[model samples]
Target: MTVLGHASFFAGRPVVEVPASGPLPAVDGPVAWRIDYPDWDNRTDETPSPGFRDRFDRFVDQTGESVQALVVGAWGYAAFNPAPIDQLCAAAPRLPNLTALFLGDIVSEECEISWMRVGDVSRLLVAYPRLESLRVRGGENFRFSPVRHGRLSRLEVESGGLRPEFVRAVLDSELPALTDLELWLGDPTYGGDTTVDDLAPLLAGQRFPALRRLGLCNAQIADDLAEALAAAPVVRRLETLDLSLGTLTDRGALALAGGQPLTHLTMLDLSHHYVTDEVVATVQATLAGVAVNLSDPQTPYIEGDEVYRYTVVSE
Candidate 1:
């Protein structure tokens, strides 16, 4: 499903947006502190209600070492800096216990997915050595370096068009504890430059042996991906395979149905697709034991001799 609101839960903790210049809530258990200017849609750089930096400072002042999870929301409407890479990296020492983080959690109202510009997120990994889960949203000006992270287990990047270099960097890195890897390979019209060939290392199971959930979703070349993934070495060991929010047709579904036996899987999400009802039955019959999400079957847009298929989250 499309992300319409703020994250309800993140990193196994319930999300609570804490205000600036306010008393800290009585945190009995772990909670993900989501920092952002209130009514941020109407907010501007001139507003007296604190900017992201001020809010972050307040949060750190109130609860520094105890903070376990954090989500960085809209930085500013017209403020000096947009991305919080510098502030976040600079304040890493103040947030020692952070294990889960979500950067650029701004919704479509604040900024479109393709309009966001994120810098080298590998710095976050380096800054938070004990981080277990990290999620980033955006694609434009996004970057990554092939850095080994030992304790990182879950990594999710929600993008309109993810860069091939970034994808390659992720696949090349060494994450001995990585279990969940979900990437949204969005529309090419919005700079989705990644190809199926770039995913070879992951499909071959060359890295991240502990990876059990693999989601190469929101792709334009889903049929090609399905063809390659049919016999990929990685699928055998995966418990969850999410090919959702893509342009997967009956042809791709048939390939998956006729390919390897995926009876071992616990969940298979193929939602928001264009597969026919007959093929849908075939897929359901093929992987009956698995919890397959075949919702929102789309009918391709037709104009004369041309047919157009689209992914779910492309803006």
Candidate 2:
């Protein structure tokens, strides 16, 4: 198992890492397969190494249809290339067992999160009908036309800022088995135009009947989100709520404490916020026994003219 640490560019936050266990055995169960850059040192170049395509082909050949949960990292300057999903789709027949796919596992050194240009992933979803979980990082030029898939249980899009159209596509799509949904509603400067109104369908509990976990994170307007979530019907039904890695402040924490009955939730993640220790303690006390994470409080500062507090990860 190779543990890869995903250290936050933002200060004070913990370095979260995922263990990559690879060279999977041909078994009839979930197996994690990692596809990394052929040459890590020269990843900034536009073209991939001659061996890169061969390596993926080799992986498909060796895995022999018993592979699931593929993690793709650094496809040699992915920002400049078409989405790697296209390539995976071409090899879909060989990876009949694949269910979970984590794309863009590239770190800051390989490509800045905001700089990673992703293309339409609709074809990839269509290619693999059995895909249950899809986690994608990077959002510039990202798109997904309305799609319907019965097996998808989790969909996580981690972008510096996600496009509103992508959010709309998810809302309009048919995902009957979707239980977990995480969207990083990043800074507006990076194309994140989704407002509280855009999330009205999800917040009203009118969509995704199986959704138990909801993450509206990495937001610039965390305070407004908190206020909206307090009154959202979906909050009452959720088992886990994540409002992390954003600019959540004391006002937001107060709204959560005073407005909502979050005791029903098993976990509430409000990590990487601008809220004070006192407010965090109060909120934790209010939601007693509800496994709350309020780490990495940001210290507000004054930039040239206006005071500023940033989301955890943005270019």
Candidate 3:
């Protein structure tokens, strides 16, 4: 049988790629697993074959208590299926070592980033009590029911547009160990209803005391977000801050440059923005030791009567 996927590593941990064929790896210490079906778009329908589940079950059987991270790639196209999560949950007793998960790793070839459907992720969190990191891509129809997990430390959601309800769900969650939080607030056209006001609690430092890294990215109103973050108490304690893949302009860059708290951060990410070269230079100079990312500067354009600034990812 042809091996569908291969195994690799990131930061010394093993990463397993689940392809359409081949036997699951029996090696231990698999930190991540990516599920991908290359023939998804060409298939007659989106429903995955029984072989998919069989492979997953085999993976569970082979890895049992060793796998720590799971990355779900394209699965036959019909939105994303929660069946894998259900399978993992049902076998949680044997997979107690699982901790990190990245859902919806599909690209434009399989499905547009904004078009990928996301179901409620509450059950997944509840099932994995030892989960330390959870990253999800795509936001259409995404929902997160209020839940608490003691070991969850990193939470990231990337989307063309993030809904307010989802943000509210994170805000309401009881994650005492959460230290890294990244939310991609995409363009308003793709269901992004959250405003800076909705993030007031996080900005005010009234939540997530253990948070050391924060990312408020892929925003349309990045300038406003920067302004809010500049004055927020949360910035005072963050070790890393990310405001990338957004329409950030000089106004936002200035807010960060002028801010005192940002100087203390070890790293600052401001890539894929609309800031001028001069502003980038100024911000970089201000935060001397901080590793800054100021790549992919965007030029403002005019389409019809209104000015247009695009986010890095949008349908």
Candidate 4:
């Protein structure tokens, strides 16, 4: 086990703890991995610390048993070229067990269009051919064309705003057999713009055939829109749901609570909305058969700046 912290080009850099192999305790298997470091917002021409790269290479080379899943983030904020990242992946011997690649804030921040669109979604997708799980944020003018892959199981897109065309592209292609979908839209500064309309349209039809988990966050959406989106017959197996924002309202709640039996849902979150005590009570009563999480009756929605952020699950 090894953890590496890196600074791109910012001051007041804090020291990061790198993991060492030993009795560090057991973690879930299946190519499970994660990396955190400086993001694209702080890029410079300076080369990364050699020690940092060396340690990473060692992890891929000497880590016990092939890593089955990888969750990478914070770092790798340089412009998207695919070559460098591909080289890094190639340096490690073939990881036969590698199945999933979890990326945080890289697709949107690092590969940002303003920086330079060296590559599109196609490039990165090909670079990490074994990726099964992908999570990204802060993308601007980034267009992705979904490619076909057989091992992918989950895809999470967390952004201030997501384009409809790109969203459609995601559903069109079969990558690693995506089963879980999570999307976060809405930019506070530009509250409700063209982007809001572009958000859910990507999921208009049977885009995700195997999707089972859906999470929507911080978007200019309404209950009706959410209800209509959730009524997809193909997504009948959805097990976990998180709809937090003003977009999810009473009508959307009623639509979901009344329609479709989400039999597998174990974790359901409905927080930071305009839900009243009566509405919450209605949901609680309707969803009594299943475990649902609604905001406390006394908890009122705060105005100006009260956004619900942060929800992480590990298994």
State which candidate has the highest TM-score. Answer: 1
Determine which window of 10 residues in candidate 4 has minimal summed lDDT.
1-10
Model 4 TM: 0.64
Cα error, candidate 2, residue 121 (Å): 1.7
Candidate 2 residue lDDT tens string, 247-289: 9999999999999699999999999999988998899899998
Worst 10 residues of 3 by lDDT: 1-10
lDDT of 4 by residue, 1-315 (tens): 001222221111222223544323344432245444433444355444244355556566654345655554444453432213443455434555555544432433334422322124444456566666554443434456867766667666555445566666666676536667776644433222324345443444345556667666655564644576556554455677777643555677777777766655776677655666667787778777768777532233466788542222100
Clashes of each: 0, 0, 1, 16
Q: Best candidate per lDDT, number?
A: 1
lDDT of each: 0.85, 0.79, 0.77, 0.50
TM-score for each predicted model, relative to the true structure: 0.93, 0.87, 0.89, 0.64
RMSD (CA, angstroms), candidate 4 = 8.1
Tell me model 2's lDDT, rounded to 2 decimals: 0.79
Tell me the deviation in Å of residue 241 in model 3.
Answer: 0.8
> What's every prediction's RMSD, in angstroms?
2.8, 5.3, 4.2, 8.1
Task: Give per-residue CA lDDT, model 1, range 1-315, as digits (tens).
Answer: 245688889988898878666697776688999887534454334433346678778789888898899998776642323567778888999999999999978777766777665778888999999999999987567888988889999999988888889899988888999999999998888788899899998999898999999999999888989988899999999999999999999989999989998899999999999999999999999989999999999999999999999998788
Ranking by lDDT: 1, 2, 3, 4
Candidate 3 lDDT (Cα, whole model)?
A: 0.77
> Positional deviation of 151 in candidate 2, in angstroms?
0.6
Error of model 2, residue 156, in angstroms = 0.8
Candidate 1 regions exceeding 4 Å error are 38-50, 78-80
